[model samples]
Target: MSPEDRPAGSGPQAALPGCYRHPGTETGVSCTRCERPICPQCMVTASVGFQCPECVGRGHTGARRATTRFGGVPVADGALVTRLLILANLLVWVLAAYVFTPQLDRVWSLYSVGLHRNGPEGVAEGPDQWYRLLTATFLHVEWWHIGTNMLALLVLGPALEEALGRLRFLGLYLLAGLGGSTLGFLIDGDWLNSRGASGAIFGLIGATVVLQLRTKGPLGPVLALLVFNAIVTYSRRDAIDWRAHLGGLLLGALVAVGLMYAPRERRGLVQGLTVVAALAVEAGMLAIGMGLYGG
Candidate 1:
């Protein structure tokens, strides 16, 4: 509703239901600049009610926000997001073979380290192994595992990368995979083996879910695809790691929160801080666990 239409003296108490953030405070406050609705508590509360916190950044000059052809889509360097991510995964696969190996099992190494925690027959022996989180993501056992994952990565990844950009999209993929691996480790911590790119891929699905929700777009196709894939993964017995998939999904969501929907001003900073904090926490936990748990 336009400001002129509403009664002035109501103190914005009845204004557009405020932000779901502050329940008590009522204020219409059109943010003076950004024009987004903000509650009284969130408002700067200036002469004409208050300005949006975003507006405060420049100290008040009539600057129009840049509008893009696609609202959420990211445009950066010429490199496409999907290609970059696929390349990164491939590089990791190579690294798992030669570079990261202080010792090489050849057969047991892939799917046992960064992206997925399983290799050979069952999940690897070491839970606190530092390289597993990143390395496990790259290794997959079955022919179909890599095939489907790479396909999905190619298809879903491009749109998301276009929306979120190369770096953020890559971050989401890695973080989700790590989360999945971490959960698998935390739950079984012993017998159950873990492996596959499904966990990290699941993260992409999670991010897409949120992106669809935020943009108010149709998720019917995405939902159907995810459901079908999930069923297949479960029926295949030892072919997939459901637990790691779930963990990676949740972690991907947390990472996606900032990348997909953070406020204009807060987006990059919030995501950066979160990634830094999560990596630090993960490192610390692994260090402590290794010291205490033997392997």
Candidate 2:
């Protein structure tokens, strides 16, 4: 009813029903949901009844839900490990590029080393030199080099980390890097010093392919990209470490396959064993390469 139609005495002092908000005025109407006295300004028309604004807001807040694209388990932002990995690579780059001398680069770059001789770069030849296998993945000599590698990591790492927990994802990266180093040591001329995270980045790519295959998703795009990258790697023989890329791709695919096919009950055991087996294979290959080089 219009204010003019209501009795003038329908004010706070009068004996009349009043809205909670419009305490000085009267309203016979009540919120259908909460049964609170409300005036026309405060009332919201529902399908069959009137509801208060606060009640509608509470309903909306409680009713909202989210789901992942694949309709699998709800997606989570598991990017902590990815960020830490990038930070580590950047920290090493900063130290090598600015804080330390060229000596640091020489120490970190992966080159052929064995029991009998230091690499062509004249890095000290010892069992300790094996560290270069892993360390090289974290070092970069130029801005473009590091930038590209880190961009790939930023794109790929979080997704893989979410698919595989932080530990396994870390294992995949390190092992792929080591696999690349091992292949470089075996095949590349002893004179060439190789460094960068391309191997690990390629591993992520390889894992993406395997992930797609395992999920029975479309493989055309991933496969085409892999082929294109491989072509580029081969074409730039002077600039690219194709051996590292190939090694990482093959090893990463193997790891992904192992992860996909592993039994759910024994998944952890299988992963640990796979990691151990990979390390053993690398060690054996290194031993054989040392023997061949010495001879």
Candidate 3:
């Protein structure tokens, strides 16, 4: 009955609508889009008025996802790539330690030429053996050697992976290893064998330092680490291939500069070219070394 015709105290009043999502809870407010009753918890503020949870979800479905600073897609697990790389390295080490023979060592180790008592054998001996340039980076001489190299990789890989993204980080790592092997082959005696991930680890170090400087992060810790490594390399020069470490460091720093400082308009093109140019430089060094060795 109309209020004017009803008694002063009404016998019954209209019941409030229950929230659509929460059937038991009463709410006066309704979603602007769907016109369904919504509780405060289900309301999502909108441009014109409040929206329900379902409406908000549908609206965002077509929106663009966020990207990282270097144009890589943001990943939920930033360290996934780093962890996989570590696993690969460990697995290779296990194979090298248990299944490999002296002959297999020659197959994987980086050497442009090695002089045996009977004859010469190594990468320069044939084009097919050039794979040694890359494979050598994954080889380790002893328990202590792999232990130290893996430890360094674990320490440095994750942060760089997060900064550079998976593809770029992987590219930097591989190229740095190649640079190290190439430079060591160029400068060291032809008979010397070089194998280890030190070059790649040093590359990460160099890149880390560059990134810290560009971002204006606290630089003292990274600088100190660099200094300590330099001292160790020099003091153990007889046992270490300092040339490889130096080569990797220089290449990594150059790559990082290009990646981090490229013009926003031409970032992708510049970064790709920088990586290609670095690779070309390594190839040129290899050619010059081969010629010098009379290979």
Task: List clash counts for every candidate, in order.
Answer: 16, 0, 0
The candidates, ranked best first by lDDT, are: 3, 2, 1
Q: What lDDT score goes with residue 232 in model 2?
A: 86
- For model 3, the stretches where C-alpha displacement exceeds 4 angstroms are 1-65, 114-120
Q: List the residue pairs that clash in candidate 2.
A: none
Q: What is the per-residue lDDT of model 2 for residues 160-217, given as tens digits with 9 covering 90 to 100?
A: 7777766778888988888887777777535558899988888888998988877778
Candidate 3 per-residue lDDT, tens place, 1-295, comes to: 7778987654667567899999899898999999999999899999988999998899899796675666566788877877887787777777777777565566788866544322245766556777888998888758888888888788888887887788888888888888888888778536667888888878888988888887888778777877888899989988888988998898888888887777867878999998999999999887876665534
Provide TM-scores for the models.
0.61, 0.69, 0.76
Q: Sort every candidate by TM-score, greatest first.
A: 3, 2, 1
Residue-wise lDDT of candidate 1 within 142-215, one digit each (tens)? 54667788888876787677677666777778878777776665554444445567788888888888888878
- Model 1 is weakest, by summed lDDT over 10 consecutive residues, at 113-122
Candidate scoring better on TM-score of 2 and 3 = 3
What lDDT score is found at residue 187 in candidate 2? Answer: 73
Model 3 whole-model lDDT (C-alpha atoms) = 0.80
TM-score of 2: 0.69
